[model samples]
Target: MRTPHVERGATPVNVAGTGGHARRSTVTTHERIDVLLSLPGRSPEVTIDDTDVSERKHPHDEEKGAAKLQQEQSFEESSEETTYVEFEEGDPSNPANFSYARKWAITLAVSFFSLIAASSSAAYALGFPSMTRDLNATQFEATLGLSMWALALALVPLWSTSFSEEFGRQPVYIVSGVGSVLMHLMVALAQNIQTVIIGRFLGGAFGSTAAAMVGGTIADIWAPSERGLPMSVFAIMIMAGPGLGCVASGWIEQNPHLHWRWIQWIHVIFYGIFLVTFPLVMRETRPGVLLKRTAKKLRKKTGNMHYRARVEDQIPSLATLMYISCTRAIYLLLTEPVVAAFSVWAGFAWGILFVLVESIGPAFRSVHNFSTGEVGSVFASMIAGCIVGEFIQIYQEKLYAKYYPTKGPEARLFSACLAAVLFPAGMFIYAWCTFPSVPWIGMAMGIFVIMTSLFNIYVAVFTYLADCYGVFASSALAGQSLSRNLMGAIFPLFSEQMFSKLTYHWGNTLFACIATLMIPIPFALYWKGPAIRARSKFASQVIHK
Candidate 1:
């Protein structure tokens, strides 16, 4: 019988480490026949299915194999020696291999970061009355301060992602956080509206990273199958953070000793603390970067001049990667039907949120005679709504695990349909009950309902897109973010005008009607989505390994 030759790239095992399974060494291969017999703890001389394989082959073939092996050995001896090392399986250094507790810690930290960023954008909205008076600006001008911040939030991240890819994630995150801290100081110390506006824009530009990259950070540590709960929590924090800011800013502005500027100063102090702490905990998570580092280490250890990974192996140049990222986002927005529909709906919802941010203080203070703090307290309803949405998400996750494991993305749409109903209903309640005779709690309840619906709709849409497009998620999310933030920035400009032309009740009624009209959209997608994805050019064609 011929002696089986080991294949190149096959490695010997250290059986103890693997609990008795022989570990393969790297940089060697074995022929198919040799490998089957090489498995340890098996009878080496045995035949498969008790077949007499030993009697089937010619006995004289061994001598010929030895001659060939000797020739190959001589050739190998003359060639340069190369030492090969095996890569660790799911390396501990890899972020994906981080313990669940550690991963959650990172998630929570990023969630807090997201909260502060979003909150700062809207926190000033409730204090616009004080801002207009102190800065000697018109109501329209005061509102522009809030609008510009949100606009910066929308546009600046397209550039920030480029920076993150260039300098590394932690550097970008820390620097951005610090930038916001400085901008906050400027806002607090501003002598004119332009200075404060510049501060707001710069603050928003820096803070935008939290909004843009938090999702990317989450994606790094969590696999798709396990991402639901952590993602929901993060998404909820992003939505609720801004509302919390409104609450605090309202209270601060109401104080006779404290003014609108204090709100900025206070946020600056809080964010400065986070900025200090961020570097200690935030670690590198990008796979390409990590893999490149691994390759470099191997080259150092082995002292082999020929050891090199592909050019595509390392993180690509920032300009090239950013262009790809932004271009794809645009392509997705232009081409994907699902993205288009969801973006528009999400945009409208976001516009409504900002409109409320701009208008709600005036409505409550003028109509109900509440102080700034009391008006801000009214935003607590939105927070309550977010909590309710989270519970709903938990329930949806349960349904996903138990009933629709194979089709969980479809199940995820449950929240979207729920939002469709609740959003419109809240609008109606808030609109018709605009009178002072109506209890203020009624208004709070209406805001709560709308917030809950918005949360459901936003999260459902976000989760759905991420699920549908695996590697393409960053780009897809960028598209949605662009639409939603643009709408947020634009909506506030027309809000005062809209309210002037229509009574408050009718204006809110119009919002309710629009929300009600969108309720059917998620349901239609839930049922028909598979078909749509099947026909999609970019959707079904791309497959993740």
Candidate 2:
């Protein structure tokens, strides 16, 4: 059979199953990080306002009800009538009802852990000078350590998310947290580059828990309305982590006694603190897993063998969700024009970040004759850029709220439209600003500008796709996440080579020109998005719904 090629806004097919699903009139989880900083596994089914979730009216509700009906019909019944269990009204056990202080505490802790994970990825690059020397590795090989970590980060979520959903986020957090610490330890003690590379891969695999799972935990604990702030903080942590890591490790690499190994050791110390306190602080937040545990206790105490959690009755295997999420995301990437366009745009933006990671040290160290510590200090501008973006987001919101009723999702495109021009503009600024005669502050300003542009791009892509796809939003976002991470992983391997041969001026210029080419994308989508989406079969499903 010939494989069919999917087209942009052109495939007029209604692939149904999640048909009749209405988007949560209230769940705004996508108003923040997810597609930019995506949830890898089975995201927690969210909402606490309604005790009888099945009774709630929305897009996903119909899908859930349809799935639940099928499960109830096939459910094996014991001679003792098996009754389904769920959180009751005013049930104190429901995590969503937790006091604001407690909720914030959980949010802060997990977000911090996730911050460390993101920091680890970029900080590994800052250590290249020392690590490559001591391990007798090539630039490409040393880069592999970072790339390996990213590969595992992108792939591990395929299964790790299943574990988090199955056992609970806390247990998975603890186990992965400890393993993450050990991987850092392994890298610190490595005798060769091979050991270092392996350590980085495992560190990222274990550390993968921090990124996706934090998003899951947020959804688990916060009601739909309450999630906006926490989710924003979580996104900040992920984006800022790499810059923070570079700052610290750059300084550490300069210390004669410390060098690269200390970079790993420092994180080991941080992860150790996270491991010890996390289990104490974060309760099992998955409501389904918690409800299942409650059913077990009730069955044992009340001597009722037939008590079962309603969530347990219809739980799809991890493999099934993984298969659908991975395949469908790929399908969307290939077939859906909106998903394809935004994903490519977001993916390149993410790749530029990694390119910066590889090039920053050399760019500053050689040109400005900066010390390792000073070069690292330069990365702090990324944080500053993100801070600027957050404030811009406030204005974007004002525009969004004021115009959203009339503009629809196109309201999001306003910032993206500006970001599209700013993105390549920022790259051009950085590309040209690299002269020794020019003050180093110019480079720093360029990084800050680039990051701000990226921040807007991330927010716009994630939110727009979420709005367009409805019940299938995760698949769309997952496509974005996959491409972003893959490019993120692949960019560094070639970046150093490009920078070395083309020179920083032209290498970044090439990136800027490519970014220039993409500038029209958001503009095109903005003017014609409604029309384009109207023609899309998958998007049309959500549009009609």
Candidate 3:
């Protein structure tokens, strides 16, 4: 009888010659066979089967057979098992692996949405006179619109981010974009102060989706190493939006024919354009959501219920997820020292910015007798400072790259230490320089310096938090956002009174002293952050990994 042929490294077919019990031998290149016999509970045995083998087989034949067996087994196993799709390292479908041009296009689109959202909050400030006059509202009541807008910006992100995490960023963007447009129309056509305030509050609530999600989207698309420049551009859009809106809204409010309603109308026009284009241009970038969708499609086509994305297993019910995400920022804020410290600094700085926005008109009007349009022009200094800060950030990026291995995530704070000092210095300069005798340029320069310092603080806090938290970065940043926006809402309400009572010089000095007290924060983080992180369970897991 012809000897039964056995392919190398395969689940060998049984041969009849081994008594009534069947035995199969799979051959390897070293002329060893792994034999499995019919004996119950017996382990596989490695042995040489040279005595029964034919002499015609060459050494190379065994190797070729082994390779073929491996290929066939791989194919069979792949067919039998349900395989989920994922982005391989260089996958084009992966947002991180997208072409540079495509990535930037997405960044710009998301950033523009952020700009619109942020700009809307401050744009209402410039129209205070018109709004007050038309509605017969008190100045304090008019300012409540700004407060409401900011409060909504702070509060809505808690739940909106949860929705984005559950549903995907694209759906959230579309719904929010449409909601913003409708709310702007509601404000534009409103006949009463109540309607206007309600519309503005709702507008801000919807608009904040862009502000809250854009950072997460950026994190999705870029590695921590490559994030600096894109993040700088995003920072510029964020910081510049309020300043730019103040300038534009001042002009709009000053125009005899346009008046305040046009402010809302103009925003509607801008948002209308966004609503049209965003759906066309923005694709879903979240990997987990994308993978889940792909798994759904594959299961549908193949009729395989076993096919599942890893994220599918972890997804909680919407109500539960929302509850967790909504409370997570508060929990992190209370528990994490790094998060709490940075949030305080960033929140204080952000409050100061909004205070400047609210107070600039009165501050300049009292000293220089500048017109409303011209008071708005002073924000240009802040914009210019942000541009300078952007360049400085480029330098910081190089420094971070050089020192990141040794310094860890704290390398991101190199510029922040300088910024901390500059913050108080600029406030001191602004306080002492607002006199008529001091040229307008001096006050402008002080504002410029303050804005530049704020820019650095903003970038450092965000990048550092992201680097430290990894997957939890979104929740960490949400804590910072809540504090910053809450402070922004509260600060402006009291700023007018503070400046009225203490005047610009002493009021600013008080702000300066507070900033000076906090100057040690960045230095502390730089020297002691790693030790602090090592001690914490959450941070230690991230640090060691």
For each candidate, C-alpha RMSD in Å?
A: 9.6, 13.4, 11.7
Backbone N/Cα/C clashes per model = 12, 2, 0
List, residue by residue over 306-341, the lDDT tens digit for candidate 2. Answer: 455544545656666667667877899889889999
Residue lDDT tens for model 3, 1-545? 11223234333222222111111222212221223211122224333344323353787876666666667666544444433344444556666777888788888888988888778888888888788899898877877788888888789888778777678888988899899999999988988889988998899899888778887788788876677677777899888888888888888888889878998888888888888888776778787777677667666765754454545544665776777777887888889999999999999998998888888877887898887788778888888988999998989988988998899999989999999999999999999988999888888889999999999999999888988887677788888889988988889889888988998999999999999999999999999999988876567778532
Cand. 1 Cα-lDDT: 0.75
lDDT of 2 at 543: 51
Show the lowest summed lDDT stretch of 10 residues, model 2.
18-27
Most TM-score-accurate candidate: 3
Residue 193 of candidate 1: its Cα lDDT? 90
- Encode model 1's per-residue lDDT on 400-455: one tens digit a residue: 66755656467768778888889899999988878999988888889999999998
Q: Model 2, which residues run further than 4 Å from truth?
A: 1-82, 302-305, 543-545
lDDT of each: 0.75, 0.79, 0.79
lDDT value for candidate 3? 0.79
Candidate 3 clashes between residue pairs 3 or more apart in a chain or in different chains: none
